[model samples]
Target: MVRCSSLLVALCLVDTVTPWAPHAAQRWARHSARSANPQDVETARSADIVAVAESFGVDVNSRNKACCPFHDERTPSFTLNPDKGLYKCFGCGAGGDVIKLYRELANATFAEAVEALVKEDRPKTRRVAEVKEVDASERIQLKQANAVAQEVYAEALRHQTSGGARQYLRKRGINPKTAAAFGLGFARPGTARSLTKDMDKSAFVAAGVLYQDGRARFGSKVTFPIRDACGDTLGFGSRALKIRKDEAKYVNSPASAVFSKGSCLFGLDVAKDAIHATDEALLVEGYFDVLALHDAGCANAVGVLGVGVTPRQLETAARFSPSRRVVLALDADAAGDAAVRRLCDDVLPTLADESGVDVVVMRWPDGAKDAADFVAGRREQGETDAAIASAVRDLCAAATAWNDVDVCDIPINEADAASSSSSAPPDDPPPDDSQDELRKKIDELQKQLAELSAQVASS
Candidate 1:
């Protein structure tokens, strides 16, 4: 009977028609043809082959002994056949090719897994059949631009007279050591044109240091140089020193060949070691919040420029600590509540299900807007280091246990009188007051009679 019902349901589903059904059928035919050709499959497979074993921090060439993701096993049962780009776990019987491994690891569908692999495997540059060699003079010019920008930014910071840039760092809880380690600096007003005189002004304009209206805008703001893991400066993030209420607070370099906002966390390069050592990360919404956390001796903190959390950021955070546990400290507004809900519902579940990362939501105190504000308010009150640390830890603990169902289960906005009356259990006795009173009087005599009957029965 169950089988018959299932068949009926399937037939019903097939009978429901859509206008795009014909187009979907055509696309499926093309996809089938692509999958059927063994030669094409082999070429595409080889060209984009990914060794899941190696990708998961394992040595592909070594014996099949590594830490398993399925269970807590010290001995490696996960075997990688790099020759075929396939992996199997003998212990847990988990097996798959590259795409399957990603699906299993990320808890995503086949299409999502394919998309993840495509993003990971795409080459940085397009392939050229014949590569042109750069001459010595051309190489020297490229090197010169790189070297001069570093020196100019460094010099600008060292010369404290350069428009209160050093003072800004001091005010933001960034000590001298941290600032120098991150190569934090101010861009001199005329320096962009001077440094890139030989190069095109378009490059500086693209880097967000100068305006395209033929004016250098560095002197108008304090700049922080953003770098890659290799310590090469990719772009600049500028905070307006003084601005009208209508002006933007922070401006970043536009997307260029080098700097991709989606792939960069503001302070991850500096904070990576600390994050790995602690096995945790505190994700704040601003650069100063990260700085404050580090200064407060909680060094495992990093902030993304935007509110949107991307897959690349998650992957990068996971690379730092495979068991990534993040505490999100966003603002305390309607937007913040919505952001937290989205993270709990969508982002964290996907990460937890696939990558085994744990995520927690930290709520700021009422009227304390964001991380920076919280830290500043505590500092003003001369709060002890221990007190501050304990507060943050408590927030993290609360966030770790946050559940959407629990939040939505209780109606918070309704009146107490209405809610209490509505939720109270029904009375067991009938509504007739005379019957209820008569029953109560009768119950006393019945209890006495029952006691007497028990004695008589015993006799």
Candidate 2:
């Protein structure tokens, strides 16, 4: 819980939430009428007392008396345990952690308050701009539609405990609890052909979670819910269920009103706090990669949902990373290679001019396919979280950008090209670091083989 709290606080510490001040009294009466979970209520309070107090207007930071948020007071009587994230106010005897504060302030039930705290990274206002503004009513309707879709998918996964989705998660080192925490689901083939069979066709389609073409787009796959920075359920990313040649390995909800792949980074809603706290954003290649790395103790990791890192996504990352430092960790395969090249050749140049955060590429360890595989193998080797984190930090430290190696984009204009042709090298340019390293490895292998042959001849 402390780990979750600290991670959350980094992104959302001072972000304003809904203006509940006016309706706080009414909400409290309603919340008190409902039953609540005692454990959840306690856990939320324990995560970050300072954040909770500050959010509710408590001047917990003052050495002098500060006004109590719970009651009208000019001077503060709040005692705090900074290490423990707990607080007690001497005035009005109002004392508790953030959960208690929320329960009091929002007049929210224990569960609702805890859930909101858990979603602390979500921004208070995240209405994205488009060509035409989305009206308030349309936004509410889309939100409701996606909410139902997420419920449907999650329920399917829950029932499929003995199903392939469970097996895939186990193989990937994701437990059911972690899956639930991330809102993972199974687009079960065992269920109806289309998840939205009973859902509103128009609304679900508009939300990009459904299609009326009589085909289930994400059928029989593990669903990773994609949300905006404000925690609105936008759409989903799904990986193939049964490994097959014909089916594409991965798929995502198409571009719709709620979801725009180019503008969205998976896990932003959850990891924004950690990103802001660390002043660094970790960009990965896919949803599982983000989850796997986070589960491996790197809380700031996010993914592009199989898309290349776009300028809009980088800008979004920059918002969370005030220091403007980001590390792009892609897979060790060809697609990953191309993605990194494009990032360096395209996005890097544009980003460089901004004088904002610097971007670095995290090269995979030898033979490591992707981040998820790397972390899983590290765990298999009995590596501690500290060791894995250290390794990640070291890899990031060694990061060398394409620009650092003097890689530059050539102008396509006739005049620029004619002038630069003489200076530009041939198509077979000198090998980069990766190529040079491979050559060295091949030379070493050849030498070892020759040595083995000599020994055999003597024998």
Candidate 3:
């Protein structure tokens, strides 16, 4: 049986037909030419009208009546004459023989409706399925390469020779136990080719473990393995321990068959259960921030990895957090504020309307640079681990919903932003002249709007 909504949608999918004249002679000529059998039309005209109506998803009582489909009505005013194969809706004054009734209900032409009533086979709309272009064997090889590379890196971080790398972690307030739990690792200098020469170098290169020329991609850096929710090592994100002037502070694995930087959130593999338990996900901006929060006993925290959160990442977080709430605890700086604005103004409203998630922004404390910094500062001030955890939780609990946050309150002055430090910035407003300049712009826009309104009214 055809559902009303499905029928309506199908009608809309088809292009509108050329207008048909109401002349009986022309309709009969077209019907005869299309069907080629007068006996088929006779049989259709003599068929059971109630059954035909039922096939179109209309319910008729024993009295051979149903509520009008052409118009809204409480009472059943659509009477069907089964023997004569006719239907009449008194409410909308729609009276028709069986063929005309089919034509109107199916949004078909006089000839098409006749063909359908005669039980003829009809053409159907074709639907195409989406096909992925990635090769399964290539993806498997990439994952295997990443797994082996992760083991090698993890062993290097723990090796006696990696004292300098371990020291970097210690300075970041990450203990050995915490680092091991997150599968944190180090890639020693000059060991890229020597360490990975026995492995399939092509697979390693594809997995972002090694460059095309065979040098380790994350050499001389503290490596953070980026994993899927099920804990498969997909790629790596590394912070250069001693970056050259031309090098980035951090580097991530390039996009591959199995890894997408924008879609995968760091720490999500270990934090999903905690996010589910708490019905919330704490969002930060870097790998260390996630580790710091986890060490402080707030285990639901994950990182966007320095990029603004993408829709795929948000949807993945929503899968774990039943409440679908994400609390932002990004860096306490202008860049972080801009991320919050972009999420609120460009991302959240559309996502909320589609899947219904709530986004909240947690303002960082005055002297905190980021979550890792905040946790380290509290520890230095002799705060207990439990106290620090409770404080972090309380701050997140008191976060303002994005809807309530006034993004305009944050100035968009590039010069001021460039000069400001994360934890120690002078507390001075933008010069009064800038405010006056903004007021002038607002006044000009208002004047333009008023003039446009007057012109529209006059027109």
Candidate 4:
């Protein structure tokens, strides 16, 4: 029999049957006390505490000190008492049981904490079978709901043929094929309630498509279902089809059972094979940007629906190609620029540390807002496919050695230029020997000026 304490932790994490809000500590305790078997409680409890501490590289036996992740201290100030399955930090005055430790250290909610602990207890040999059973069932249910939602939204889009959604896509230059490839459909305002009338509204609510207050409340917004790599609709990201300068541009589904914004890559399902074939993935900001790239025949592209790239998404991308090379092509706006920087400083470094994946920023034309904007503007100017191809080739070439070169001067040697021309200008005419001393001073100043210029350019 499984130990009660360990079983409780495992059960908390694995069973999503309870609907209490994610981090309700009281609810978890009540549930654990009521449902957990007596024989398994102590052992389960000890195992969970040990596992969580071990995960943070804390020694289970040490009572005096353990690594403190909160501070930069080299010496350990945290103490763990394995006998009682508790921890206390001498330096920070932090004290907690296994659950509390998880909540603080992992930033996990009560439900998530429970689920994680339970998962850790699962035997390795049974893990695959258990996951398959759970995933298969959940996937089937999600696919069915998604299929229904997709059809309903598509039908609504047809009804609103002349509405703002159709116009919005057209304005963005998203063609029919490109739109369909992304399952781009419209949500009639207040239609979510009607569409999910016969279904379990809770499931829809959990998926972030429908709102609940005893009954469903579908807002007057056009919905875009965000799907996963396998084409299962995970959640909906909605936009106000009608033009309202005051309204928010888009509203995404809240955290739900099927959808995790962190784990889902917007176009990876459709772009997976292409990404794998090319051994590259283009990261973009929004859904439309991804569609635009695919429509333009650049199929090896995917986007994180939002700016933040999660560890799970990075791992998923790495699975496609061991040497994952992600080219970020975010927008030109301040938020977009910030996102790009975050991707470089935060997301990329973490991913590299975790998976050894390489990340590159795609150099967009200075004024272009995004990939869609880039493609649409190029098309409007009658730029031929050859021109677009050439631009992409240039970006890829630049990406290859972006790290090695001085960020200031991206060397652009004309392909047809003579080899000698690509090198430093032919030795400057020898300075007059009589004027050498004065000339040397002038040369030093010029070199200093050049160095300053390069530094300014890089910054």
Q: TM-score for all predictions? A: 0.59, 0.58, 0.62, 0.57
Flag the better candidate by TM-score, 1 or 2: 1
lDDT tens digits by residue: candidate 2, 55-105: 655555545235554333345575766566556666433444555556555
Query: Residues 104-196, candidate 4, lDDT per residue (tens digit)?
Result: 566544444445555564222312323222233554566566667777787677674537777778777777777777777776655666566
Clashing pairs in 3: none
In the range 1-459, model 3's lDDT, one tens digit per residue, is 234345444444332422222232343454345442567777667767788788766789999999876444568999999877878876544566887677656655445665677774331212153324564567778888888888888998988999999999989888888898889998887657655666767778778788888788888899999987767788899998887998888989998767878778899888988998998999889999999889889899989878577765776676577678888777867788778767766666555643466778886674677899889989999998899999988998999877566545544343345455334546754467855775676566556656656766898
* Number of the predicted model whose lDDT against the real structure is largest: 3
Candidates by TM-score, descending order? 3, 1, 2, 4
Model 4 alpha-carbon miss at residue 86, Å: 34
On the 0 to 100 scale, the lDDT of residue 331 in model 1 is 67
The lDDT, on a scale of 0 to 1, for candidate 2 is: 0.66
RMSD of each: 14.3, 21.9, 20.6, 20.7
Top candidate by TM-score? 3
**Candidate 2 backbone collisions, by pair:** 11-273, 28-107, 65-76, 66-76, 324-357
Model 1 scores a TM of 0.59
Count clashing residue pairs in model 1: 2
| Collision count of model 4 | 12
